[model samples]
Target: MPVNMAEDGNVAPGLSAPIGGKKIFFVRHGKTEWNNQLRYQGATDIPLNAEGRLQARRAALRFSLAKVDAVISSPLSRAYETAEEIASFHKGAAVEKTSLLTEVDFGEWEGRTVAEIRENYAEIFEAWRVNQLNVDAPGGEKADDLYERCGELSKLLLARPERSIVVVGHGAMLRALFPRLLALPRVSYFWRTRIDNCSITAFGADAGRFVLLFQNDTTHLKVAEGRIASLPLL
Candidate 1:
């Protein structure tokens, strides 16, 4: 069983700190061509589109006022580029790439649109929607595998020296990891949670306990008008 760190309306005790807890700002990578097309891009390295770059710039402006100590990102180009934008605003803050932050592998589903998947793999899609934890994308990574990776990521983040940092990653991976971080059930994965491109989520650690301060905040991108594309469900 996965470790439960959070409870209903209460924070869990985890992620130890020497002096005090750290603040982690989690940001989904900027929009990609696949995102605009409503395609599953798991483990598919796609670069940010023009709108994505603009969104990253807006995010950078928002974080410019923040005391960001470091910027960490998935090895994928979209995530790495977004991290670069955030790091640009913070002097001496370099972007660190980690494979642990990569998107969940989609296997046969990679690069396929929702419509395509539904038309061909309707039953599989339904199975995934009903209980993603027990389903796999043909040959992709399973929910349990993702959960384990998320745990690894939690440990990696907790082991970081920086108190304030930014993490850029994919939608599916973030959604999968959120339950573990907040002590929610794996069955609740992706439930009522929407991770838009360049959206910001905040968390703080206190004496090893992780507290979710906010989730999927896009106030910074509101000024971008329609340039911010609609996020597709992958």
Candidate 2:
């Protein structure tokens, strides 16, 4: 059963029992140059850097042993490339793009560094940091807008015939959506919730509700890093 939207646009547990066991792996895309520079890349189509590629490869290796049924991604190149890496391990799996999965629109702040935003738009930035749900990015989107899209995405994933699905997307959007899916307070959404590049968060359907299995699991990357470090030098 798919989660339904409440009158307040929050996620509500479905009334009907789920037909079959279903799981969702929410994967954030690997790092990009913008990510390394701490730039606001909302809606900016930045490609992955060398380190990002390695991160994606490590993430791929992690999922290679899992029963991944489908790969869904944001249209952004960084996310799509990461999804491609995951799809490589799952033969016959196709990567599907969804606009709903795209990163939050940064508006005038896109491509700007946090420092720059703080220097130029301190009031707006501070307001957003304090209460993101109520504040809109200067000419960009508010938290509620992102929640609506994520709500749509939740429904789409629930409707899928596949039992196990991998959704690759951006950090901001994922962070924004996480609270809604868990029915947590919107104010508590981003605080202390780490959604690292190529990190995997998992959820499982139980009794017509989505239960969070884990959040920001990147142990596989640590193993991969150890393996790389252990390689003999030529």
Off by over 4 Å in 2: 1-20, 225-234
Q: What is the C-alpha lDDT of each candidate?
A: 0.82, 0.82
The collision pairs in model 1 are: 14-208, 14-209, 15-208, 16-208
The parts of candidate 1 lying over 4 Å away from their true place are 1-20, 224-234
lDDT for position 28 in model 1: 96
* Per-residue lDDT of model 1, residues 1-234, tens digit only: 665444222334454322236888899989988999999999999999999998888788778767789999999999999999889979999999999899989899999999999998999888887767678888899878888899888878877888898999999889887777766666756655899999998887655557787789888788654433232211
lDDT of 2 by residue, 1-234 (tens): 664533222254454333246888899999999999999999989999999999998888777777789999999999999999999989888999999999999899999999999999999898887767767898897667877887888777767878888999999889887766766765746555799999989877544457677788887677755454333211
Against the true structure, candidate 1 reaches a TM-score of: 0.85
Error of 1 at 106 (Å): 0.6
Error of 2 at 139 (Å): 1.1
